[model samples]
Target: MLRIAGILLAGTGAAHFAAPQVFDPISKAAFPDDTRQWTYRNGAIEVALGLALTTKKTRLLGLAGTAGYAGWLASRVRANRGASQ
Candidate 1:
C-alpha cells in the first residue's frame, strides 16, 4: 500500500512539473496574483514528499504529505461550498 501511494505521489508530482498549465488555473483561483510561482512551489513540494515516501526512514515525510493533502482537500471543499452558495 505504501509503495502504491508513493508511486502515485511521485507520478502526480511529476505531472505538476511536467504540465504546470494544468494546475495553474486552480492556483490562480486560489491566489490570483502569483499563480505561476505557487504552482511551481507546489510541484516541488510534491516531488520532495513523494521521494521521501519511497524511503523507510522518512515516515515523517509521509505524515507531512498526508497533512498537506488533507489541507488541500479541505480547501477544495471550502471552495466548493462557497461556489454552491
Candidate 2:
C-alpha cells in the first residue's frame, strides 16, 4: 500500500515537470510568471518524499512529511476560500 501511494506521489511529481502546464493554474494562483520554478521545487519535494515513503526505514518520516505537506495543501484551500483554519 505504501509503495503504491509512493509511486503515485512520485509519478504526479514527475508529471509536474513533464506536463507542467497542467499544473500552471495551481502554481499561478500563488505565483506570477515565475511559477515553473516553484512547481519544480514542489515536484522535487514530492519526489523526495515519495521516495522516502517507499523505503521501510523512512516510511514513518515520510508519513509525517506527507501530513505536513497535506496541511500546506489544506492551507491553500483555506486561502482560496478566504477562510481561517
Candidate 3:
C-alpha cells in the first residue's frame, strides 16, 4: 500500500509539473480561488520524497513530505473559502 501510494504521489507530482494546465483544473476544484501556482519544483520535490519513502530508511521522510503537502493543500482550501466570504 505504501509503495502504491508512493508511485501515485510521484506520478501525480510529475504530471503537475509537466503539464500545469492539466493540473490547474484539478487544483482549482480542490482549492477554489487559491491562486498558488503548481510548478516543476513542486513536482520534483514530491518525486524525490516518494522515492525516498520507497526505501525503508526513508519512509518517515516520505510520510513527512506527504503530510506537509496535505497540510499545504488544506490551508489553500481554507484560505480560499475565507477570502470569498
Candidate 4:
C-alpha cells in the first residue's frame, strides 16, 4: 500500500513538472511570449525524483522533492493570481 502511494505521488508530481512542455500548444496559446527555461528544468528534476521514489533507498529524497515542488507550485499559483488582478 505504501509503495503504491509513493508511485502515485511521484507520478503526479512528475506530471505537474512536465505540464508545460507536455501541453506546449495550450501553454503557448494561453501565455504568449513566455518562454522560460525553468519549466524544462523543473520537468527534468521531477522525472529524476520520480525515478528515485521507485527505490526504497531514495524514498526520503523523493518525498522531500515532492513537498518542495508542491510548495513552490502553490506559491506560483498564488502569485500569478495576485498579479492578474
Candidate 5:
C-alpha cells in the first residue's frame, strides 16, 4: 500500500514537471511570483516526499508530510479562489 502510494506520488510529480503548462493556472493563482518556479518546486517536493515514502525509516514521516502537503495545497486553492473572486 505504501509503495503504491509512493509510486503514485512520484508519477504525479513527474507529470507536473513533464507538463507544467497544465498547472499554470493554479500556479499563477497560488504563487506571488515566478509561477513556473513554484510549479517546479512543487514537483520536486512531491518527488522527495515520494522517495521518502519508499524508505521504511521515513514512511511514517512521509505519510504525515503528504497529508500536510495536501492540506496546505487545499488551503491555497481556497485562498486563491477567494482572491480571484
Candidate 6:
C-alpha cells in the first residue's frame, strides 16, 4: 500500500514537472512565469517524500509525507473556492 501511494506521488510529481502549464490556471496568487519553477520544486519534494516512504528504515517519513499531502490538498481546496464555497 505504501509503495503504491509512493509511486502515485512520484508519477504525479513527474507530470507536474513535465507539464506544469496544466496546473497554472488553478493558482490564485502565483505569478504566471513562476509557475513552472513552483511546479518543479513541488515535484522534487514529492519525489523525495515518495522515495522516503519506501522503506521501514524511514517509515517515519511516511507520516511526514502524509501530513504534507494533506496540507497540500487542503490548501488547494481553500484557494480554489467557487460555487461550492
Give the worst 10-residue stretch by lDDT in candidate 5: 76-85
If ranked by lDDT, best first, what sequence of candidates would result?
A: 5, 2, 1, 3, 6, 4
For residues 1-85, could you state the per-residue lDDT of candidate 2 as single tens digits? 9988998898888899999988876765544546788788778888988988998999999999999987886666556552221
Q: Which one is best on TM-score?
A: 5
lDDT of 4 by residue, 1-85 (tens): 5467666655754675656666444333322335345445555666677776778898888788878977876666555553433
Q: In candidate 1, what residue range of length 10 has the lowest lDDT sum?
A: 76-85
- Superposed model 6: Cα runs more than 4 Å off: 27-33, 72-85
Best by the lDDT measure: 5
List, residue by residue over 1-85, the lDDT tens digit for candidate 6. 8877777877877777778777555432333345567667777777777777777777587768769876885776566556232
- Cα deviation at 60, candidate 4, in Å, is 1.0
User: For candidate 3, lDDT tens digit of each residue in 1-85?
Assistant: 8877788878877887677777665566445444336455566777887787677788898898889987887887666664433
Name the regions of candidate 5 deviating beyond 4 angstroms: 82-85
CA lDDT, every prediction?
A: 0.73, 0.80, 0.71, 0.60, 0.83, 0.67
Q: What TM-score number comes out for model 3?
A: 0.70
Candidate 6 similarity to native, TM-score:
0.66
Q: Candidate 2: give the clashing pairs.
A: none
Candidate 1 per-residue lDDT, tens place, 1-85, comes to: 6766777877887787789999887666555556688778777777777777777898577868768876984686566554432
The true-structure Cα RMSD of candidate 5 reads 2.0
Candidate 2's TM-score reads 0.80
After TM-score superposition, the amount by which residue 69's alpha carbon in candidate 5 deviates from its true location, in angstroms, is 0.6
Alpha carbon lDDT at 24, candidate 3: 64
Give candidate 1 misplaced runs (Cα > 4 Å): 72-85
- For model 5, how does the per-residue alpha-carbon lDDT over 20-81 read when each residue is reduced to its tens digit? 99976767777646778988988888998998898799999999999999888888777776
